[model samples]
Target: MDLTINDRVLVVFAEKAELPVAELDLDQTFEEIGLDSLHLMEVALWVQKEYGAVIPEGDLHHEQTVREALAYLDARTR
Candidate 1:
């Protein structure tokens, strides 16, 4: 999906991440940014509040990287 200006997924991801927003190259994969599982959970919680959806605990547990977590959120949002 094309990221909307106020896309909460991107918002929370960017806010919690250590990198500057301008540096989050869209061409790069989320894994390349190096956010750990704990931070992923922080993003997930933000997703839940922002999008108002439930992310399954099982899937969240197995999501080992940022890319995987993005895919999980994408599926949930759609």
Candidate 2:
């Protein structure tokens, strides 16, 4: 599914982790989604696949918010 930044994060929370997007809080740490380090990698992989863009290796761990992740991608896509 084509998604905005918020949408992408929510989809990762939902589709991959089986959480409901509506239940996610924007300010909540992604930890609240219960992802471990491996899941973080999965999210990164999914993001890359969905966007057809590889997020830099380090940024995946650095970005703590959907908006920030999107900004990272936006900067790269330019």
Q: Which candidate is the best by lDDT?
A: 2
TM-score of each: 0.58, 0.64
Deviation in angstroms for 29 in model 2?
1.0
| Candidate 2 to truth, TM | 0.64
In model 1, the runs with Cα more than 4 Å from the true position are: 1-6, 27-31, 58-72
Each candidate structure's count of clashing pairs: 0, 0
Q: How many backbone clashes does candidate 2 have?
A: 0
lDDT of 1 by residue, 57-77 (tens): 545543245445566677787
Model 2: per-residue Cα lDDT at residue 43: 72
Which structure among the candidates has the greatest TM-score? 2
Error of 1 at 75 (Å): 4.1
Candidate 1, residue 54: CA error in Å? 1.2
